[model samples]
Target: MRLRILSADERLQEAQGKTTMALFGPSGAGKTTLLKTLPTEETVCLDLEAGLKSVQDWRGDSLPIRRFADAVDIACLIGGANPAAQPDEHFSEAHHAHLRAQHPELAARLDAKRIVFVDSITDLTRQAMAWAKTRPEALSERTGKPDTRGAYGLLAREVIGLLKHLQHAPGRTVIFVGILEKVVDDMNRVSWQPQMEGGKAARELPGIVDQVLTLSLFRQDTDQDGAVSWQHDAEKGHARRLVCQSGNPWGLPAKDRSGKLALTEPADLGALLTKINQTLKG
Candidate 1:
């Protein structure tokens, strides 16, 4: 195929497109609950964590969830090229056929959805790691010592493939849910980031997504009756909110490509999407 140059109109149109969001926060910070507010009818959520207990109250017909039995199930969806028939590749026709037969809904949603949500990318990473261990190349026949180092690379490739797949889906948005972990240095300085097993995936994931958000809570005490009250947003929203900043004081590594929003109070994806739309229009 010959390379063809695109017109100015085409280039501009592509530039105006929206990018996906990568949401990460601590458990009980309402990451899952906030995601529940999205319109389920137009969204597809992959519940790789099995029973999403926090979203138990969600009444939008069980939140249009698709369950993945294990890591290989997800690996099969993001195909690539591998003689081992790695989840990223379809080197074996039998492997692809088995995956399609088992996960038809997931296969259909791969590139044909408006909104795709993967509940907890951290879990996805874990699943990928598990699948990596099953690969023969990751094992040493001599000592039978598993190649833990090699598994990290496979895990990263799987996640990167998944992100790219969702990002290129026509007119669709992807939200990768992940837990935030607190790390302390030798000096006791603290920082928060996505909770992934492998250092490679956790370290480099922020650069792969359009936005990285951190959710937190704010507390205040009443003066009149000496009552304690809690409110998170400085401007508006609820008792909690999601924050996005490029190296803020809170020790979260976040970035926004549009540079339109600094924080999203109440930590709701629905509101974030609204702000994104408004900013794009402006």
Candidate 2:
């Protein structure tokens, strides 16, 4: 085997091009409407939740994801194949070729776009979980009784693997949208997390994507010193804010691995992506 080394300039160029972001927020936060902010010509939305009803006036292309196979096959078509995957894996080189040969038009639709938006990974995970329940892992080998643990285990691997494959798609920017759920523990402590079928997905997703952002409402306020700050208040007049990094006062689930974003940005996905790419280039 021959080994090739990348120069420092080459490495920097490779790192600067595209972004993979996970955007989550509560229902009715206009998460779906944000798709309209993206450039219609270069963007394609994978409407997994059929949530495009809110953005009907927006002019852009969309693909519906109704089944588990649709999610996996579309991902493979967009991201191409994973040479490292086994032959049996859906993202394997062999499977990718088969899909391209069979559905050339479907492949072309995604290939023409640079941005791939997966609307609501929560529904995608539900689809995966539903499929997992029918697999051998969901049944006990000895008693043949239903095994929820096995199903959940399989579900985690499938969801995470799909996410990682999409993350590595060359020259493509991918955004995974998810519902953010508010959870109160038995001790009465409240926390917010990405709403997915299993706990593992929420924990693993922040690590997989380049950015984790939460979109929500915040009241514009002024302190005694007349310094402006945004606070989460129900009674005050509120506007949408995108929490881009962690340790924010709202305690939202946010992370910016690129270290290029401000703690808060305007709730515009297109502007945010442009800012990130610009910073990356600099």
Models 1 onward score TM values of 0.75, 0.95
lDDT of 2 at 153: 97
Candidate 1 local Cα displacement, residue 223, angstroms: 14
lDDT of 1 by residue, 63-182 (tens): 333332343444445432233445545334566577778878767766344566777787878777777778776777687788877777777776675566456544667688888887
Q: Which residue pairs clash within candidate 1?
A: 79-88, 80-88, 80-89, 241-266
- CA lDDT of each prediction against the hidden true structure: 0.65, 0.88
Runs in model 1 deviating more than 4 A are 2-17, 59-112, 141-144, 220-238
Q: Candidate 2, which segments miss by more than 4 Å at Cα?
A: 1-3, 234-237
lDDT of 1: 0.65
For model 2, how does the per-residue alpha-carbon lDDT over 1-282 read when each residue is reduced to its tens digit? 346899987766776667899999888888888888899999999998888999999899999889987899888998888878899987999999999999998888788898888998999999999999999999999999989999999999999999998999988889999999888999998889888998897789999999999988888878899999877752353788889989987789999988989888988889998888777667
